[model samples]
Target: MKIVLASASLRRQELLKRIIQDFHIVVSNFSEDSIMYNNDPKDYVIKLSQGKAREVSERIDHEALIIGADTVVVLENKIMGKPKDEGDAFNMLKNLSGKWHKVYSGITLINTKDGKSISDYVCTKVKFSHISDEDIQKYINTGEPMDKAGAYGIQGLGGIFVEAINGCYYNVVGFPLNKISGMLKQMV
Candidate 1:
């Protein structure tokens, strides 16, 4: 069977390579509006992932294993998505300093042939060390936090800010390899 990825994120692409190296990339045009859901984080993420996979599945011509994922950072029950600007990034970083937050990743797998699908969400608790304003500013200046949830990338320079994590590191990066692999096994 052919394999396809339904996301444009370089992080997801790179992480998925650890499992399937020959998959095709097909970005989904499903615009994510977290505000509309306002439900449980798990439900929100799963819906988003399924939406992406379904969107891509509709566009493909042949049977393929389509993978889609969505990730979000939650602080005090509020969902934090990609920052809008440098100021937004800075505020997010400031709020995250010296605190523990949750990272939720939802993965969905779709078989275009029979329309079979599986979706699950994983949550990771991450703690950030107290960082100075100057350091936050310096990190923000790199522009790394602009396009990342919670205004940080745990696998990049932002890793320095993380003091501890209670779950899969790959989940924080965007996808959960363990869950994805297990789901694929079930599909087979």
Candidate 2:
């Protein structure tokens, strides 16, 4: 069966390549803004993932395994998605400075043939080093954090701010490889 990824994120695409060498990309039309966060970060992400997968499944005609994923950075129970603008990005970085935050990734798989589906989540604890306002501004100037959760990308220029991490490193990169592997094993 063909495998389809329901995301346009380069980081997610790169990570998925490590496991599945020949999957197809079908960016989902599902809008993240349509989903409301009910104070439950895990559930919120799972819903978003499922929404993406279901939306993409409708666009495919043949048998395929569709994968959808969403990631968020949570600090003190507050879920942080991509910033709307540079100012929002700066605020997110300032709030994350010198703090331990949890990065949660939600994965959803849909089998177009049998309609079997699975949704799961993985969380990683990431601690950011103390960031000065000047440094945060400089990082913001790089324009790397604008499209990332918590206004930072652990795999890019934002890596310098990360002092330590616990749990799957791939989770911080927006895809949890081991968790997705296990989920695929159960599905197949």
Candidate 3:
């Protein structure tokens, strides 16, 4: 059976690679801004992921297993997605400093052949150390947080600021390996 990924995120691609070495990437043409927020993080992410997978499924001319994922960082009920600019990144990092936040990753697996699919989400708690303004600037200068949700990546330089994590490390990285493994086991 053929496997396809319905996302353009390098992070998600890398995470998925750790599970299966062979797969094709089909960037979902789904417009993300079309999603409406309902204040439910898990539901929101699942919807977004499913939308991506569905979009890709419709575009593909052949049968394949398609995977879609979406991640967000939540702080005090506020959702922080990718930064709009360097200043936005700085503000997000500042808000995350010395705070415990939740990272939610929603994953959807679609079997286009029979239209069978499953969607789920994983949440991880991450705590950031008190970061100084100077350190934030230096980290921002590296341009790592620009494309990452919550203005930081636990797998990159942003890892240094993480003081504690209470759940799957990979979840903060944009995919939850343990949950995904179990979910895929039934599919294959």
Candidate 4:
């Protein structure tokens, strides 16, 4: 069966490529703004992922396995998504300075042929070293944090701020390769 990825994120695409070499990209029309965070970060991401997968599945006419994913950075129970502006990015960076945060990624797989679906999540704990205001400004100037959750990207220039991670590195990168691979194996 054909495999379809329901995301437009480059990070997710690159990670998926490591496991499935020939999957197709079908960016979902689902909007994250439509989902309300009910104070449960894990369930919120799972719902977002499921929404993306279901949206894409409805748009496809052929049999395929649709993979949908949503990732968020949570610090002190607060969900931090992409920053809206430079100031927002600065504040997020400041809040994350010298602290441990949780990265939660939700994955959903839908089998178009049978209408069966699987949804799961992975959480990774990431610690950031204390960052100076000047450094945060420099990093924000690079524009890497604007499109990333918690105003940072572990795989990009923002990597300098990350001191360590206690879970899947891929999960912090927003794909969770091992989890995705295992999920695919179970579905197939």
Computed on alpha carbons, the lDDT of every model, listed in order, comes to: 0.92, 0.94, 0.92, 0.96
Q: How high a TM-score does candidate 1 get?
A: 0.97
Q: Report the Cα lDDT for candidate 3.
A: 0.92
Tell me how many clashing residue pairs each candidate has: 0, 0, 0, 0
**C-alpha lDDT of residue 10 in model 4:** 86
TM-score of 2: 0.97
**lDDT tens string, model 1, 1-188?**
99999999998888888888899999999889632657489888999999999999999999999998999999998899899999999999999999999999989999988889999999999999999999999999999999999999999999999999999999999888999999999887
For residues 1-188, write the lDDT of model 4, one tens digit per residue. Answer: 99999999888888899999999999999988999999999999999999999999999999999999999999999998899999999999999999999999999999999999999999999999999999999999999999999999899899999999999999999999999999999899
Q: Model 1 shows how many backbone clashes?
A: 0
TM-score of each prediction: 0.97, 0.97, 0.97, 0.99
- Candidate 2, pairs of clashing residues: none
Best by lDDT: 4
Higher lDDT: candidate 2 or 4? 4
Best by TM-score: 4
Which tens-of-lDDT digit does each residue in 70-177 have in candidate 2?
A: 999999999888899989998999999999999999999999999999999999999999999999999999999988888998888999999999999999999999
lDDT of 4 at 22: 95
How high is the lDDT of residue 143 in model 3? 94
Which ranges of candidate 2 are over 4 A from the true structure? none
